[model samples]
Target: MAGIPHYYLYGEPGAGVDRDLLHIEPVRDRSGPNDWRIRPHAHPDHMQVMLVADGGGTIRMEDRTLAVPSPGVLVIPAGIVHQIDFDPGTDGHVITAALPCLAAAGAQDPALGRAAGQAAAYPLDGSGVDVAAAIEAFRSLQREFLWAAPGRRAAIIAQFSRILVLILRLSLIHRAPAIGAADHDLLVRYRALVEAQFRSHHPPAHYAALLAVTPARLNAACKARAGRTASDILHDRLVVEAKRYLIYTESSVAQVAHLTGFEDPAYFNRFFTRRVGCAPGAFRRQAAES
Candidate 1:
């Protein structure tokens, strides 16, 4: 397959957006020009959050497609391939922040990191007032971004953090009960370790050693929180990167295997096919065709 496009945003090339802190804009400003359809692309160091106030449509992230309705939130993490098709006349706000900025924020609140660590959609439920308040927060963010008033930068950061916290609250309400704090911390740290060292091909035992926990304990934490074994979590991370490389780069299957941490191309092919239901070459071809 040929290279899939990478962009900073919809029209903005990845290299052109130099701001490392944040960028806020309305959805229509970018999507309007493209007939409201954003093609599949990946951002190397930015994470995006979209709050849908009025209309909605489908979001394609990696291999999963999600339907988002009005009064919803979608967070796209760095390095994930994603596309969005908005309904005509859709109205909403989109914020693209440097992944480092998010990482800094997450340092203060690890839950925030988990919420934004992947592509997720949260459709707001409850009284109209709750939804209206979330929309107002988006408008407030936009105003501060435009006016650039005194202390505007701080205000923007604060408002953005508030929005994330609010969404976290809503997500928790609709999802399963929270896990134990100790277990949750271990799980979060495990995920962080996997993100940083997946390319190095470290085993789950290495991660457990780094986290000062036994392999059984790490597996238990992962199972309690994500319903997956620690080894499965590690393998899933590798598979995700494999799919990204296959879809976005012009690299050959052997090169992709090497890049994703497999020294032997044959083993990589078998691993990918077992987890992704197709060989790397076929996955690339399918992404190109779709």
Candidate 2:
């Protein structure tokens, strides 16, 4: 596939330079002008947290599309290819900040750091979270971001950090079976390896060897942290990459299979169809028509 668009902000080309950058604006400011649709794009060096205070829609991340729950929050990590389609007149706030800013904020709380590092959506209604406190934090962040008052930077970071804490609380409530720190660390390492070597078609066992762990241990860690087997994680990464090529490129099915590390196009076809419940070509066509 051709290079996916990378922007500091959705339509703005080029990377951001400000290490302390923290931008907050109403969601409609950008989404409204574009008909409430944010096309597939990536931010190379920044992360975003969005609060959906009003209407909602769907978010397309890699190969999956998830409904955006209103009165919710979305944490999007840097370098994820995503698209957002919002219902008209959706009102909310989107906070875009440099990765360093988040890292610094998360330094004191590892859970907060972990929560902000992943892409997740949480609905505020009936979740037992302090929704009012979270909303007020967003409002406070917007005010601090808009002004040049003394200690503005500190105030912005403090408010944004509060939001992250709230998100972490919600995530814990919705999380799968809790995993120990070692297991979580192993899962993170495994995911990083998959991101680097997925196109090589390495088996999960190969990854386990590289991590100096047995296959059983690797699988156990992945299951505990991600609710998936080690093999499932590798296969899911492959499927996500295949979907990206199919949707964003003009490559034929055979070429896509080859690009995704399958020497036998027929095998790739079967694998994709079984996992996605549709042939690659059919999925592409459906994506285009939608």
Candidate 3:
């Protein structure tokens, strides 16, 4: 593995975009130039929301590759290593917003925040959402993003928030009815905590403590909402991050172990093999070959 490219936008290498708050453009504007294939990359401080209006392809986030449905929405959180292969002439809009902008929006609505943080695809065909209205919203957002009019920043935020709220609704509609609101909310908070602390290798009890709940309560909530125990959620997050490091960095296996919070390289190797069915070195070699 070599160093993965970190870009402000897909192919643009820079600290940040000029607009700073948000950037909107047709998917073809960037993907078309690269033959509709975006290689694996990460944006350190930006998240992306892509609306695929026509055509479809596959998106790879870390080790998982999922097909993109036409007339769907895709969310990519900041700092995630992802790639997208779009069908030629795929028509859609991609919205790139700064982390601060998302944070501000999330401060107002936690559900929206959670939805944005997750990387997912929501097909709008049978989602009960007004597809035409959603497209109009994207167009309005792109217009505001391009114009140098007064109150441009606020308008962009407003439009972005609207899209997020729509995504949230779609997520809720698709979510299992078995999970109650309180359990869902707790799961959301638990996920947020995992994202922040996964690299530290903390136990579930540590997270439960931070969330002001007992470990049993946290585990139950996680089981109800995510179909995993709280410990599983934490360990799964750790494994995902470990896979990212192995696939994206040229660090030695031992170094990768320490970087992912393991003190003993042998222990890390055993852990990786147990969960992933291969040693870290083998995993990296396989990824490179693929």
Residue 152 lDDT, candidate 3, scale 0-100: 82
TM-score of each: 0.60, 0.61, 0.61
Best by lDDT: 2
lDDT of 3 at 128: 94
Residue range with the least summed lDDT across 10 consecutive positions in model 2: 176-185
lDDT of 2 by residue, 127-198 (tens): 898788888899999998878898876788888889889879888876623322566568767876887688
Q: After superposition, how far is residue 237 of candidate 3 from its true place, in Å?
A: 24
Cα RMSDs of all predictions?
13.1, 15.1, 13.5
Q: Candidate 2 regions off by >4 Å?
A: 14-19, 176-290
Q: Write the per-residue lDDT of candidate 3 for residues 95-178, one digit (tens) a residue.
A: 888655775556677889877867777788999999999989999999998898988867888998999898788778776122
Clashing pairs in 1: none
- Residue-level lDDT of model 1, residues 28-81, one tens digit each, is 888888899988776654678888887898988766778876788887766566
Q: In candidate 1, residue 82 scores what lDDT?
A: 76
Off by over 4 Å in 3: 176-290
User: Comparing candidate 2 with candidate 3, which one achieves the higher lDDT?
Assistant: 2
- Give me the overall lDDT of model 2: 0.80
